[model samples]
Target: MQPKLPIQCPSCESSLSVTQLSCSNCSTSVSGNYTLPLLLQITEEEQNFILQFFLTSGSLKEMATQMGNSYPTVRNKLDDIINKINQLKTK
Candidate 1:
């Protein structure tokens, strides 16, 4: 499996910025400081939840059933993610 991107500093636990990117096929490299997208800045679990939400056609009931969680639980999870996204947008 591919390694996950490290978004936080290992020692300080602060957010990290992208410093370089490379083209896999051409071996071309680009270097610059850049912030990760809001979606990518979230935890992987949150990202997967968002993906699952879309895959289920944005149906909370379907998501709850698929996750073996109660409807309110799934709804709360979605609400939390939405709040996080909004907070990120303001920054």
Candidate 2:
């Protein structure tokens, strides 16, 4: 399996930069300082949540039902995710 790209440093919890990239087909490598886009910096769990939320037609009630979580809980999680994304944008 291909290793997933990291968007943050596990050690210090700082945003990660994509310094090197390679072509999978021909093994060509490129290196530079590159910042991970804010959207891409979102955690995998958040990504899954976004996907599921869209799949459920943006209905918090449906998300709660699908995840077996309370409606308020689902809403709160969504709010928190939105806050995090907004914070990233301000930086």
Candidate 3:
């Protein structure tokens, strides 16, 4: 599998734009500057949390139970993720 592309620079913390894309099956290529979706900009840990949240039927209580944390903690994390997405959208 291809590795996940970096959306943020590690040094300056700037956004990275995609300049090239190709289909592995057909080898067809496309080139342009493309901004990754906001979802892709978040950390892998946050992505996994999103997956876990969906797998648990989007229940904060269930996520807390699965993660051995409190419901408020899970809710806060979700809130932070949402707020970050919102901020990114406004950019």
Candidate 4:
């Protein structure tokens, strides 16, 4: 089977050459070169927030409740993340 491409760095937009890629479901190494957007290059906190947002099915109210923050606060953070993604695309 053809190998999947390597994932790229979100900040630098550099292609990540993985020595071993594994599937979370099967724990199999599906090694290859892949490309991803630079926006993935974020701090752990940011990553967690993103993951939580997605895991919560993009429910801002849920995120706010879970994060113990206001709706506007969660929205601001999400907006900031989106802005960063947009900037990277333009670059």
Top candidate (TM-score): 1
| Model 3 Cα lDDT, one tens digit per residue, 1-91 | 9887787888999999888999999999999998988889888888999999999989889999989999999999999999988888999
| lDDT of candidate 4 over 1-91, digit per residue (tens) | 9863435565897646445568899887876654444644555567788899989999999999998999999999999988877776776
lDDT of 1 by residue, 1-91 (tens): 9999988999999989999999999999999999998998899999999999999999999999999999999999999999999998998
Off by over 4 Å in 3: none
- For candidate 2, the per-residue lDDT at 2 reads 92
Candidate 1: stretches off by over 4 Å: none
Better of 1 and 4 by lDDT: 1
Pairs that collide in candidate 2 are none
Model 4, residue 48: C-alpha shift (Å): 1.2
- Please provide the root mean square deviation of candidate 1 (C-alpha atoms, Å): 1.0
- Poorest lDDT segment (10 consecutive residues) of candidate 2: 34-43
Who wins the lDDT comparison?
A: 1
Name the Cα RMSD for model 4.
7.7
Which stretch of 10 consecutive residues in model 3 shows the poorest summed lDDT? 2-11
lDDT of 2 by residue, 1-91 (tens): 9998877788998888998999999999999998787778899999999999999999999999989999999999999999999998888
Error of 1 at 49 (Å): 0.5
- Taken over the whole model, the C-alpha lDDT of each candidate is 0.95, 0.92, 0.91, 0.75
Query: Please, what is the TM-score per model?
Result: 0.93, 0.84, 0.89, 0.57
